[model samples]
Target chain A: AQRVTQPEKLLSVFKGAPVELKCNYSYSGSPELFWYVQYSRQRLQLLLRHISRESIKGFTADLNKGETSFHLKKPFAQEEDSAMYYCASFDNNDMRFGAGTRLTVKP
Target chain B: GAGVSQSPSNKVTEKGKDVELRCDPISGHTALYWYRQRLGQGLEFLIYFQGNSAPDKSGLPSDRFSAERTGESVSTLTIQRTQQEDSAVYLCASSFPPGPQQFFGPGTRLTVL
Candidate 1:
């Protein structure tokens, strides 16, 4: 079965500090990678997909086939950046999501 | 335009009872998906509906769970003999066909006591 792994369940960072949400997946025939986020009371929404190769809200993720990783990164964290982030893999009619990482950006 | 809508934002039921959750996808989205999220866990995809084709029910936990989509429009997921373990937020999402990105609904919180 295809799987996505997010090593950190919770991560805390101070404002102005850089943030990275680690995501790794077991590749099975070129799966698409995605990052989804859920704000405090908002619905989960698509942050970015690897295919797009574009940054959203100052966050970017690179799909590394060699590392099987698609880590979300932001140079400087902000309070609004605190949310639940999930990494997902979809391929071969199978979609697997990581357990998610709760990021807390302290001021 | 409405992104995606789910009925009965919350539902509480007793064990062994059945519950039906409804989802109304975006206007022209051809793909719809149902997922279950336990507290502090990732999405457990339950089913997928794409246009009028056969849905991918591979992620369904058991035969007691079944879903139907009304020709790329409204979808309903039914859970029979609900167990306490089934308590979770049932989320619905939709996207254009051949596109893997999804837009999610607010979710239906189901508590099976």
Candidate 2:
């Protein structure tokens, strides 16, 4: 079975601190990984995708096939960066989402 | 252009009642999707619609749940005999054909009493 796991329910960090939100997945075939963020009073939006190899809002995630992980990272955390983040994998016509991690950046 | 939109931002329904949730995908988007998010949980896929092709309803949890799309534009999810477990936020999303990126709507918060 395909599954996505986000071990942390909440992660808190101070401004200027580095942040990492862990995500892991189990799948048999090639996986398409994505990071989605939802800000307060805003709709859920795509943060980044592994295929594009692009960073959004100073956040980047690298898919590590060895450990089956796609952890999102930011060198410097900001208050504006605080939001609920979800990791997802697209399998054929189905998409599996992790439980999600809520990040809080305090000043 | 406007993003995907879902109707009834909030709905309070009695248990055993029927309710309908609507979604309007972005214009020209060929793929539409429905998902459920219970409090403190991640989004759960419920169904998918692509163009005029038959919809993939495999994610639907039970026969009480059904959805239909018209001409690749508007879609509606109907739930019969709502249960307390049915209380959740129903989200709608759309993406361009063959595109991996999906845009989500604000979602409808359904409360079953």
Say which candidate scores most in lDDT.
2
Global Cα lDDT for candidate 1: 0.93
Reference-based lDDT, residue A45, model 2: 92
lDDT (tens digit, per residue) of candidate 2 on B1-113? 58999999999999999999999999999999999999989999999999988999989999999999999789999999999999999999999973558999999999999
Q: Clash pairs of candidate 2?
A: none
- Against the true chain A, what TM-score does chain A of candidate 2 give? 0.98
List, residue by residue over B1-113, the lDDT tens digit for candidate 1: 57899988999999999999999999999999999999988999999888888998988999999999999789999999999999999999999863558889999999999
Query: Considering only N, C-alpha and C atoms within 3 Å, which residue pairs clash in candidate 1?
Result: none
Whole-model alpha-carbon lDDT for candidate 2: 0.94
Q: Give the CA lDDT, 0 to 100, for residue B49 in model 1.
A: 88
- Report the Cα interface RMSD of each model, rounded to 1 decimal: 1.4, 1.3
Q: Against the correct fold, how does model 2 do in TM-score?
A: 0.98
Q: TM-score for each prediction?
A: 0.96, 0.98
Name the regions of candidate 1 deviating beyond 4 angstroms.
Answer: none
Give me candidate 1's TM-score against the actual structure: 0.96
